[model samples]
Target: MSQFALLGQRRFAPFFWTQALAAFNDNAFRCALLVLVAFQLGLDDHAAAIYTNLAPALFILPFFLFSASAGQLAEKIEKTRIIRWVKWFEIAAMVIAAVGFVMHHVSLLLVVLFMMGLHSTVFGPIKYAILPQALKSAELVGGNGLVEMGTQLAILLGMIVGTTTMGAAEIGPWLAACITIGVAVVGYLACRAIPAAPATAPELKFNPNTFGETARVIRITHADRAVWNAVLGISWFWFFGTVLIAQLPIYTRETLGGDNTVYTLVLTLFTIGSGIGALACEKLSGKRVEIGLVPLGAFGLTAFGVDLYFARHGVAPVRGLGWLGFLRGAGSWRIALDLMLIGAFAGLYVVPLFAFVQARAPREKLSRIIAGNNIMNAVLIVAAAGFGLGMGALGFSAAEIFFAAALLNILVAGYIFTLVPEFILHFFTWTLANTLYRVRADGLRHIPEEGPALLVCNHVSFVDPLLLMANLRRPARFVMYYRIFNIPLLKFLFKTAKAIPIAGQKEDPAVLQQAWDAVDAALADGELVCIFPEGALTRDGAIAPFRPGVEKILARRPVPVVPMALRGLWGSMWSRRDSALGRARLPRRFRARVELVVDAPVSPEHARAAALEARVRELRGDMA
Candidate 1:
């Protein structure tokens, strides 16, 4: 089923709406305040600028101060209770905001903004930490996609409504107040429908010190390099977004020389593109948490950003054109497409990273880790603002700033991917496996989600390890024949993947011994290890004799043994079937059909090498 089916389910729908509405309410309040400060506050330009700019910082400040505490609370208390309380706090904040609006009290309204920020900080952990508990592993990416799409659209709507309502001449403040309060109440009602989310760590004592807790949570987030990089990736996205969004209004008015309508049109295109891209994650990823998409997104961001800079490079100013008129203007369509694609790529870039962080973080500390992510995000957002201001101070135009940000994106992406090669590695493996053949994997659920297991598959071809690695959800450490393991172009990947290489006893006794030692160590560390029971590739398209190396490994540490087989690879280019440079193997069947068939795992005590060989042969059947 498509991920949209989640929107209709009780388990997800209400929480989704509650979160989306909260986003809507936040934008509504913030935009309303900005409108008031700009048009009605009657302050000097300097003072007005201070309030307008400082408003966002006030909102973000809470994330820096209270996110650590909020994360811990989500871990200690049932999440639904927190959601309900947060909703109540939202209502209270809105009420205070209403009085601020009616009485023209800027100070009261600023406090209201800070309270709303506090509300969001408390909800941030619950928002992400709840997903892993609610959805299956396969659904994590799609679920996040839907949430992201909803949030993007909600923010758009709230910004439009908040500005429209508050900017009206008659009863504007009261209308904004009513709208905010109504959304808050409806959000609370939605929270009632959210199912109970039990505490992930109930026994953990509270850390009353925010600074110490912040340090501790950040340490936990840093414990895993991949997760920490994922957090950085997320933070970079916020920085990217904040810079672009902050520039859009000025870009619209100063560069395009268009009025409010044109500004709204560009923002709409960007936000809608983001929502569409978010929804596309499910189909693009084939329902997996595919981090490779992050690279694709980064590429798009850089490419389109440069294109956008050029699209509007030297346009002369035009006055008060509607969105349609702007479209009719020279180079406008290209500019429009550029903005939309940037937003879409932003969606592609961020959704999977969020899902990966959710999937990989330890359950007990998931909330705290999310809090760490928030702190990082806040810091990056501040940096983005400073960067943009620094660029503007250098007298760069908005288009130049866009170009600079785009170029900076390359450096940022390069740094992150370098820090963690798994993304690029996954990109390579995903591309190669998807390109070479159509692989069908059966009984993948037979592999355990956690802990050590021994996978025994009949050796098929030189690329069997790659196929298995791509298809398996949990990572596997492969034990391969030393020659194939050292294949020149692939040797680097093998070592990076930590594959164990071995040779026949006569060829290399030391290598064989090291292979066994590695297998035992992997299992002891609770990692999956896969070995070919038939140690050599079939010479005549038949299963080779079972090797006793597997039996030896299992003897050292008894673990679950899963038997599997690769089918339809006998005549592939990588296979040894018709060995005249393998040209005879290359006809008609290019991108051939291949299958990795897995069977139920057996206990190590019952899993002899011969038994696994027989099982794999049975699974392979007549495919060869």
Candidate 2:
């Protein structure tokens, strides 16, 4: 089903609107305040700058101070109740904001700014934590994509509406006040319909000391190296976005020589592209939380970012061009395409990371981990602001800053990928598998979502492991013949996947023993291990005798055993079918139709090699 279907479901629709409206109100109020200070208040430039600068700092301060507490609250209290309270808090803030707007009370508006920030700080944990509970494993990525799409569009609309509403002649302030409060109230009503998401750690002790709790949460977040790096990757995304967005206004004015209409057009293009990309995740990922897209996203962000600098780096000769006028000018299309792709890639980058964190983190501690992510995001956003200012201070053009950020993305992505090679490994396998074949996987649910499982599959081709890796919802370690595992070109991928390399007892008894020990250890540690019981690929398109290795491994670990089969691969590239002189033939057809069929998992006691081979043969049928 399309991810959009979730929007029509009671489980998702209400919460979606509540969060979207809150985003709208947050941006609308902030933009209205900016319009007031910059254009309406008639304050001098220096005074206006003070208020403008103070606003973000004040808003971000709450995240640094209260995120830990908010995380704890989300963990201890039922999520819907907290969300309702947060919505009420937003209404109260808007009430104060309404007064502040009518009286032109800068101090009061700033206070409301901080209040909205606090509101977001409190809502942040629940926003993510609730999703995993509400969504099935299949729905997690789609759900996150929907939320992200809503947020981007909401933020864009809010900015446009707020700016336009507040820019009106006389009724602007009152209108802005009315709109924010109304949105807040509607958000509260929407949130009331959100289904209850019970706390994950209700029986756990709550930590009240902000500093101590913050430290503890951070430590917990960092406990998993992959999760921690995902958090850092997320932070880097915020940093990149902050710099890109902060420069857009100036970029529109000085570089593009466009007025506000053009600015809005560019912003709209970016946001819409992001929405499209976010909504595409479920389709592209095959309804799975596929991290392979992260590398793809990182690549696009850097590529377009550099291209954006070159598309139009210098100041435009014409000034005050309207939206249509800007489009009519030279190179405008390139600039627009670059911005749109940048946003699209950003969507691809972030949604998976969020889902990965949700799927991988300990359920009970997930809220606190999300809080830690928020704290890191805030730090990077602040740093990005500083980066923009410093670059501008050094007389760098907006385009130069873009160039610098793109280059920095390369370094950042490299560092993160190095720290977690699984991302790169997944990317390689995902790309290879998707390019080589159209895969239809059935009965993936038979593999347990968590804990140890032994997967036995018929060996079909050289890329069997990659195919399975790409299709399996959960990660699994492959046990492969040592020669294949040590293939020079594929060595890195095999090592990163932690594939156990086995040798025949006659060829290398030591390696065989080590492989046996590794398989047992991995199972003991609660991980999935997949092995091909055929021992060698069949030269003919027929079932081969099942080796006794699977039985031996079961004897050691006794994990649940799942039988799997790969169909339509016997004649594909890298299979032995068309081989001559000990080499396989090139692919005769691109994107061959392939299917991974998994049967119900068998108990270890019943999962003998002959039985698994019979089941796999039954599953494969005459397809091979």
Candidate 3:
């Protein structure tokens, strides 16, 4: 089914709108308060800074303190009913905000902000946990993409509305209050339509001790390396986003010299870029839960962040120009563009990480895992604030700080990717294959997560192995021709992947021996080893008769042999028939929808070359 079909279904749409509207209201109220404290109350510069920073701290504080309790609530109760109660609380919080605004009471407003944060903290686990319950596994990525896109756009609109309404000449406070209350009401109504989501862990007990429960939750999450890594990835995104958003006002005033226009512009560009990047996940991921996009996002974040620093440094500050004039200004435009792209890349970076966590976490404990993620996000955001403060104390200009942040991003991203090589490896292969041609896969579940498995497939493209490698949940060692393994541009990739290179006996006896030994060692270590039994690209666009070498390899180890097929690769550049000079050439962009169909695993005793070949051919069907 298509991704958007989820939106039309009863299970997802109401909750999606409810969450989006709540996000919108939260930002609108926060921005309105910031404007009031900055301009209407006649606060000093330092006081305004404290208020702005303190607001986020106060809001996020609840997650750290109450997330454990919230997680238990989500796991133990019906999610739809819990969400209904959360929405009612949102209404109560908004009512308080409206009162505070009308009274021009800053203290009361701060209290309301904290209350709102607490509301969100209680809703956090349910927000993510409900998705897995409501949507199918395949729909997770697209559903997350839509949620992320809607969220960023909502944040942008809320900030625009809040700042605009707060700065109005007359009745600004009243107008802000009315809009905030109205949006809250709409959000509550949306929540009312959410379909029932049964409790994942009905017997889960409540734990009130914050730190103890937090530690327990972390311990449980750590049992699954992939899920824990994804949680850390999500936390890092919050760190990056917090730092960027925190600097915008400074970036606007000091760098661009526009009052509030530049502030809104930067925020809008970043948020919109994020939205675009988020939506692009569906296309880039090929409608799968592609965690590879996480590393891709990190790369873009650092790349664009570095460029933004340089771009801003090169720009001569525009003294009096408004937002439009600043955009038209000579170097300033580049900085603007850089900010937008950085945000876009960030969107690309974070959405899939969230989906990966949702899809991989144990079903019963998903809510607690999400709660743990929220707690970590809160911690990272707080750390980001401190980092910014430290940078400022060292007498760094905002531009210099931006550069420092960009450099730091490289280190952090590198560290995360090192801890999780799958992300970087997946990014590499996905980028290579997607850029070269459309890829499709089938029967991927036949590839065992552990133990020795020989994957025999028809070779149709130079990148076919990489595509298969990228999609598999576990790392795989591929046996390839010596020359392709030595290709200069792809040399580092092959080395990093530890791909085994082989040659025919007449060409290179030592290389063939090395290849065989490597395959044996990999299988002995209980790792998956994939071999293109065809040994070369199909010259006639048909499965070459299976070679006896596969039979020989299996005789030694007697491991499971998974029969697989690749379709729609015959016309690819590497296909023997497609080459103009009897060599591989680049194919058209996204033209073919390739598929990898994996048949049931065949035991070594029963596996025969002809039998495996015929089974694969049947799965490949008329596509070949």
TM-score of each: 0.96, 0.98, 0.83
13, model 1: CA deviation in Å?
Answer: 1.7
If both were scored by TM-score, which would come out higher, candidate 1 or candidate 3?
A: 1
lDDT digits (tens) for residues 288-326 of candidate 1: 778878998999999999999988865446767778889
Runs of candidate 1 with Cα error greater than 4 angstroms are 580-584, 587-592
| RMSD, every candidate, angstroms | 1.9, 1.2, 5.0
What value does the lDDT take at residue 158 in candidate 3? Answer: 87
| Model 3 segments more than 4 A misplaced | 44-50, 314-318, 440-456, 459-463, 471-563, 568-612, 621-624
Q: Tens digits of per-residue lDDT for model 2 on 1-624?
A: 778899999899999999999999999999999999999888999999999999999999999999999999999999999999999999999999999999999999999999999999999999999999988898999999999999999999999999999999999999999999999999999998999999899997888899999999899999999999999999999999999999999999999999999999989999998887788888888888899999999999999999999999998788999999999888899999999999999999999999999999999999999999999999999999999999999999888999999999999999999999989988988899889899999998798989999999999888899999999999999999999888898888799999999999999999999999999999999999999888888888898999998889989889899999999999776889867656667777889899999989999999888888889999999999
Clashes of each: 0, 0, 5
Candidate 3 whole-model C-alpha lDDT, 0 to 1:
0.83
Worst ten in a row by lDDT for model 2: 578-587
Off by over 4 Å in 2: 580-582
Model 1: residue 557 alpha-carbon error in angstroms: 1.7
Candidate 3 total steric clashes: 5
